[model samples]
Target: MTKDVEMAARNGSNGAVAGEAYYPPPPAQGGDVDVDDDGKQRRTGTVWTASAHIITAVIGSGVLSLAWATAQLGWVVGPVTLMLFAAITYYTSGLLADCYRTGDAHTGKRNYTYMDAVASYLSRPQVWACGVFQYVNLVGTAIGYTITASISAAAINKANCFHKNGRAADCGVYDSMYMAVFGVVQIFFSQVPNFHDLWWLSILAAVMSFTYASIAVGLSLAQTISGPTGKATLTGTEVGVDVDSAQKIWLAFQALGDIAFAYSYSMILIEIQDTVRSPPAENKTMKKATLVGVSTTTAFYMLCGCLGYAAFGNGAKGNILTGFGFYEPYWLIDFANVCIVVHLVGAYQVFCQPIFAAVEGFAAATWPNAGFITREHRVAAGKRLGFNLNLFRLTWRTAFVIVSTLLAILMPFFNDILGFLGAIGFWPLTVYFPVEMYIRQRGIPRYTTRWVALQTLSFLCFLVSLAAAVASIEGVTESLKNYVPFKTKS
Candidate 1:
């Protein structure tokens, strides 16, 4: 029998491939080619490429809004909160790597769908609900990213004399236009026929991201508040040392958001490793991915967080734009804005891909004959576009851009969208994904001292996230209350 014919039979009439199925022979492996192209089967991602994905994914608009979020949590606790969260994120990612390895070894399924495994093993609707929430959270994350990118780019352009009036309202206008433009650009960049070569783009993106962040951090440290005549003076005491009790609680809760961000992407790192050609049996790829990812993310977080608190002192905000905008000579604002724009593009790619894929997946099932609306159709069109489709490949790029533009215009005013989204959406994806996966793989992850300690910490992290989500939503609502048009004054 032919290879396709055999797979079709083995896969059954419903077209569902069994989770426990093993690789058949060479011809069969080569025959079922939907997952990877010929070159893709041979291409493996490097440590640098994996690192880029992890770092970019974590450093979204949240990096920009972190200052504000931390401030809302309490200014005195801001930096401490960032550091505390960074530590949790680092450890949680490590624990996730261990869980992934254990599960893969036991299941003999190196390429397991995280949700499928979790859902099957946990056998709980809440687990599945969490997974669904994760997916939605990621979508919100993409929205947050694109909106932030628009605002950053607008701020950069205005500072560079691109905007004539330099109007505050223009920030929102420029942001919306950028959303449309970036969406178009992403369609092409994403459609690159040669993904192996695309690693170079990720490299350039990473260099831009890290280098700009480093410089921004440095400039922030060297900054001195000036008088009206522009004369510099020593001012702005160090922030976040010996914070008050309320500030301490705020910092702790903010830290939970950071942990959620890290947890959300652990499975992505594992997926990328598995996709590599001739992957390590000992799975050294997981170690490499995690080590580089955690280290890079931690360093950037520290640099941005510390310099920001130190420079602006009480005035500093959490977002990268805040760090970028607080520098002297004015021209630095343009430079910082530009860096944020470039870095945000790379970050947006990682955040948007899964949401786009999920939307495409549902579209395909719901409307099998919708032409280019399905993921399969988009892939085929992408093959034709060869990475620069302009407008043809993946039209949803335009739709996403439009949605993001509208969201950027509206939600940014809310000022706490990042924290709110991170709280409501990011928590389940990051905190619960690994724990649920581990529970599925090995019941309750053993009650050893270390495991028990981690679980307690994880549970605490969950509670913090729950509180943050609730508080942020309430805060947003309260802020909106002031803007609401009432018929009568109180």
Candidate 2:
């Protein structure tokens, strides 16, 4: 049977003997392909859990900034650019799914992580490249979330402490203090044993995301309908379009980069897909999960971006929630900010898990017993935990949270940090790797039009990323011209 399976795999057909047909294959006899100590696999999720994970990872603080992005590009370019990103992301995500599987049923192999896939299809050097960008992007994303959560907490706190005359009664409670508080909370939640353990947290985070997004859209609609007449503008005409063509073009590219960043989840697709049950249909399941997740996210992005632009016109803040201030409808604003805080807590974990997994995997490979919890310790603890909370894991994860928190407190320009992350992360993780992997996996000819087009697209994405990096640096430099550390935003 094994020889036949190998032969069929070599022939590039489903693993069936000459006389036999490939019908529905039998269920995997093993409990799970990725089993734990008790001989049970942890792959116990369905499409819903997978969708929840994708949604939680994808629709983060990025959505909060889309209105400002829209304002930069105006309604026509903004919505169109967002939809374009959605399509491109969806297409490349399918390419990634194809790379996850190799060989035929009985003799097939699956990539357990993104780096695994990269190393398999590309080279070890490329794997290292992917890992570097992947970890940096994840860490940057977590820092962004820390800043967002701090902002939400500060808003909530200030709302509770405000007087009737629009003054913050407790002005001393700054964003940095709340950022520290958020970091402490994350240090606890970041200890979840594995990606599978975060399934429920992702679900709750998705719900929280939906709650705040709905509130944002509702608030925007209400303001547009009931507030001052002629305040909202659709075209750039009323908002006073950028007079200089060069400035207008730069803003357009910046918005493009922001949209690309908002749509990025390719970095963690394999990690999330690993939690799905093993079968012939795992790839299909993952594709469906991506479609469902992206569809839901794009809908919210469009509504929030369009409505937010309409409500604020050219005056939209980097964070749409900030537009509400600490005044009337303050309770709703507080509730929405609380939802954002809760959602980002889960988002921080979602992005950070891949980093933890990669570090632990590397440690295990480097030192055979590095990530292990000894039998003696397990017995003393009186529990059969699936993962080791060894000294390295405890120390590094804690330090990562601490460092990211400090960075957030030190540099609180949300949009600038996001632009920087998007610039550094978008090309390698989102565009270049996936397209190159797909072309290599399929043996596409180098000089063919398809190959050339994709390579061109990757180069274009790289240029956009570079421009965004420069713009972000300029923005940060302007903000920090005085170079004050740990300065809170007023």
Candidate 3:
């Protein structure tokens, strides 16, 4: 096992990375049928299963913001931006998948996580940078999910309130309380051992994503066909009419960040790839999965975003599902919000598992003799379902949940926070590191045609990220003028 990637502290399971002592050993396997190159349980993730995981991670929370993002970009740029991100994500993700193995594409040692991949190809400084950016983004994502799930939960109540007390009802939604509830729910799911134990949950979350996204799309299409839609133009919102030139620029840049955020999951690409079994090679399987996943997500995004802009035009709500874009068929709207909450529950774990593993793994490795870090007590719950409880994991994970929940309560500016996270994470994790690692692993010479082209692409993306980050900060600053801490309205 590589020192850079001893992501778990516990002994045994040669290929294991992330979350110590939680994995069930391979079930009495024979031959190489159920074993990996590192001689642990052969990963059972196929292209479809991998695609499901990708969809689960990519589609939640971000999809809800697409309508407003599209409105900012207008008809011409909105759809174009979506395709551009899909293309960039697919291309760079392909580059990353090839870096799964250290030396050769097939038989080289595995790099199980994103930081592991960076540590394999880059120097110590770059490795440290990757760890900071990747882990921070993962924790940020956990916060974003808590905020989104609570918004959806509150939206359900708001919808019901409006249905009962007329459309003008002041449906008071307590976001802090809902955020706390979401935190409590995450505490339980956070205990779900490791990455490999997440297939079924990811599948369920993927289904929920499709369900809510499809509902939003169908509603938007209906509104589009019903006539009397809001103002729309090829160039998007007019500078003098909808916003000042400065506001226009900021909103457009923030819209770019939103789109970038929607295509996130590149930070965890290597981790996702690690779950795939070999034979066709992890890279090959991951590439196929990325194609299927990105294409599927792109198609749905087009429907949800473009149709939404058509329906509501420049007035598109920040979150189509929970932002009151659709009110009729209150039951369906409620169901859609419910699905969003459910989908985010699974997506939350998908991102948080890496963080949990990094911390718990370090604890176990640092103090090999510490029973508190290594011990597990199997406990039975209602219906007698069995699970493990580790003292350190329980304390640390609960604290993380509580902290994220509190942050969500303090700053519930959903779109601004998502844009900020997206802008900061998009360039380095998604584009730069992958491009650099690919060049180094393939030994592409500096200033060569391939190297120059890759560098040019990265530079352009860096510019985009810089602009979006600035815009997000400005948006958050603007939001602060009327903001009251721990009080978020729907």
Candidate 4:
């Protein structure tokens, strides 16, 4: 499969729920030709390429909040939590990879997407639930991206203001305005010709993610080595000194959600698996790739989160780059923030375009004869530089952008939002679905020790998600008391 397949499956996930079983179209008979059994070009992906894809998909702007999360959980719980989440993701990923082939791990019909696997193994209700999770997660991600990008943009402006004026000068930049500007930009990009086909956008976003993550790690390392670090404890922030007991509990819960968010890539694991060749079987290769990617990612996260905590223990900003953690090296900070804005611009489309396509596809299917919905008018600025514009496409995409931006404005609590998104996704997408699928596929009987273990694990994660959601909501409520819409500051 091409990278377009990966990007489509990355966010809005293939398409809507058709409420039917997924059966792969029969391959052409006597397929000993150049094409694979499925009649597509033979995949050339190796364990290394698969590993690279997994790493890129997992690490993103989400890593920026690790230090703050670490501070909430303190030294002991923080790293342990990161490692634990990594292990869980890795194990569940192997289970998911096994589900890629319906019957056998090596040679059953390919279930190309997560929904494909769920539809093949699970029930109709599961298919619908999976669709809801994928779509809701994609839309929430769009809104989260908007909020994150605007904060980075406002950080640049605020950094400039601080540099120009005295240290005490008010350098508050309105986050909601930046968010609105970003929404307007996305509205324009939404109409690009075959926007999903611009696979380079995904590459660019990955590069930007690495650049900022590297900058964050470097800055935090420098801060730690330079000495005079803040107070840090094995138990983390003090209950009475840094926060009240209730606030401590809330922060810990939110911290769990934040760490969960940092590892949010299981939704696309099957797509990544689909890219691999099958001499060694895609499942085996994907299992290796998951080990490499998750292990490497965990090490990187430890460096970023641990060093940032060492630099500003109990005071790490929710976002390392935009959170005013470092004032000097203003140029580097500005560049990092610029990279963030650029990355998110593409990453937004990486996710939201699938959503746009899914909705537009459903509309066309529903109203086949409606010209406004089904017809694409080829509008040209020049002979060769134009795209087919449809009224439904333009209006629906714009409305989506507007609504997401408005939601971001209403609740501009960055950490709280990230935590909430993570909590909502962690249980169902990462744990429940994969575990359930593994059991059904393997025909594990009920009340078996293995079955009980899986269910127990799922229940534990559900409790964590529940607690995280409550904490994030509480955090948002607390934030609302201080800031109104259009008034969030850098």
Best by TM-score: 3
lDDT of 1: 0.51
Scored against the true structure, residue 337 in model 2 reaches a CA lDDT of 94
The parts of candidate 1 lying over 4 Å away from their true place are 1-40, 66-80, 98-107, 124-127, 161-174, 190-198, 224-264, 318-320, 323-328, 359-398, 443-451, 482-490
lDDT of candidate 1 over 1-490, digit per residue (tens)? 3443234223311112112111111222335454432112343666666676676666555555443344333444555566666666666555455544334543343433334344444556764575567556766666666666666666655555434454343332334566667656665554532224445565666666776667666665666333111111122222354355554454445444543443346434443443444445424555576678666766676666555554554455545454444224457666766776777677666655544434433443344434343212211344334222212224665566566655555555424566566676544555566665555555555777756865777787677778767656655675577653221111
TM-scores for the candidates: 0.73, 0.86, 0.93, 0.85
Model 2 pairs in collision: none
Sorted by TM-score (best first), the order is 3, 2, 4, 1
Best by lDDT: 3
**Relative to the unseen true structure, what is the C-alpha lDDT of residue 9 in candidate 2, on a scale of 0 to 100?**
22
Q: How do the residues 234-276 of candidate 3 rate in per-residue lDDT, one tens digit apiece?
A: 8788899988899999999999998899999998888788788
- Candidate 2 lDDT over residue span 161-192, tens digit each: 67443573554456888899999999988776
Q: Compared to the true structure, candidate 3 yields what TM-score?
A: 0.93
| Residue 318 displacement in candidate 1 (angstroms) | 4.6
Superior candidate under TM-score, 2 versus 4: 2
* Model 3 CA deviation exceeding 4 Å by range: 1-35, 322-326, 380-385
Number of backbone collisions per candidate: 11, 0, 0, 0
lDDT per residue as tens, model 4, 201-304: 65676677778888888988887888667788888889989999999999999999988888887776776676678789889899998998898778879988
Candidate 2 deviant stretches above 4 angstroms: 1-42, 105-107, 163-172, 229-250, 370-389
- Reference-based lDDT, each prediction: 0.51, 0.75, 0.85, 0.78
